[model samples]
Target: MIQRIQTIFLFLVVVCMGITIGTELWEQAVNGQSWKLSAFAVENLSADGEVVSSSSKWYIGALAAFVGLLALISIFQYKSRGRQMMLNMINSLLMVGLVASVFLTTNGLNSELGMEVAGSYKVGFWVILAAMVCNMLANRFIRKDEALVRSVDRIR
Candidate 1:
């Protein structure tokens, strides 16, 4: 069961979330300096002279980690395709929330710093998008499996 296609897709989902931890989804430029916001940290790339580091919002990182771990755990629940589907749905919601929170945070940061934020989406954002798609596909496959099992039982 661990060798199931949905398991592989779930693992890919986890990898995408893990990679998101290190990549930025948006970039903002304030006074000619660019600041890229990632899931775990924000880096302020100074254009003129000095460099400063920005700390991360712990909850965002925690949510992302939770989603990834959820997917990983979902892979093991082969006995319960329904449960796996539920987990995938939950993961999907978590990812949507993560994206929304990121945008909200960027808006707050922009106003605080008097700058405009732009979609300088790095590798991380795209990965998140991929995870979203994978989650949907996993759910589809889980439902398919469940239906197949039901039909087999009916035949028996």
Candidate 2:
């Protein structure tokens, strides 16, 4: 079951979510000010590039961890594709919230620093989006597998 294509996809979903914790989600810089947001922390810098402040944003990290845990759990539910599919859907919704929260928090922080929302999404954003895509792919394959099993049963 672990060798299945959907299993691989599901595993990648977990890996991507886990990686988000260590990566920057968004950033901005203008006129000697810069702000960077990661999963668990946000950094602010003055014009001199000195570390002005850093604050813990634990909720982002916690949500990301929950998403990863769900994907990992889904990978092991190979015997029940229905349950796996449900979990995948839930994971997808969670991922959407995760992305929105990251951007919202970053924008809030950027505004506080008097910088326009000029920065694009960083590597972490892409990774979470990748996980969402993987979850969708895995769900599709799971449905295919269920249909195959039902066809074989009906033939018997």
Candidate 3:
């Protein structure tokens, strides 16, 4: 059961979240200066590639890590398809929240600096989307497995 297709999907979600944790989610270049946003913080870099300043964003990282943990836990719940599906659903909501938090933070950063244009999203942001897709796929397969089990029980 643990070797099912859903397991691979859930594993991909975990991997994506791990990548999100280490990479920048968004970035912007303004007036020859650049800012990079990661799960833990945002760093303002000067033209010469020096850290001009940094601001904390620990909550984003925490949420991403939580989603990853949920996926990992879901992987081991192979015996309970219903519970695994529930965990997948919960992970979906958390992923949405993570995206919202990143978007709001990026907007806040821009407004605080009086910038009219928005920054370009980076790998970390996209990775969340990929993880969300994988979560959905995992849920679908779990549902199919549950249905199959029910059908088999009826046949017996």
* Best prediction by TM-score: 3
- Per-candidate clashes come to 0, 0, 0
Judged by whole-model lDDT over C-alpha atoms, candidate 2 comes out at 0.88
TM-score of candidate 3 relative to the true fold: 0.98
Over all chains combined, what TM-score does candidate 1 have? 0.89
Candidates, ranked, TM-score = 3, 2, 1
Error (Å) of candidate 3 at residue 84 is: 0.4
Off by over 4 Å in 3: none
lDDT of 1: 0.83
- Model 2 TM-score (2 dp): 0.93
Name the better of 1 and 3 by TM-score. 3
* Model 1 worst lDDT run, 10 consecutive residues: 113-122
Q: Write the per-residue lDDT of candidate 2 for residues 1-156, one digit (tens) a residue.
A: 677899999999889987898888887877677777889888888988788999998999999999999999999999888999999999999999998898788778767666655587899889998998999999999999999999999999
Q: lDDT per prediction?
A: 0.83, 0.88, 0.96
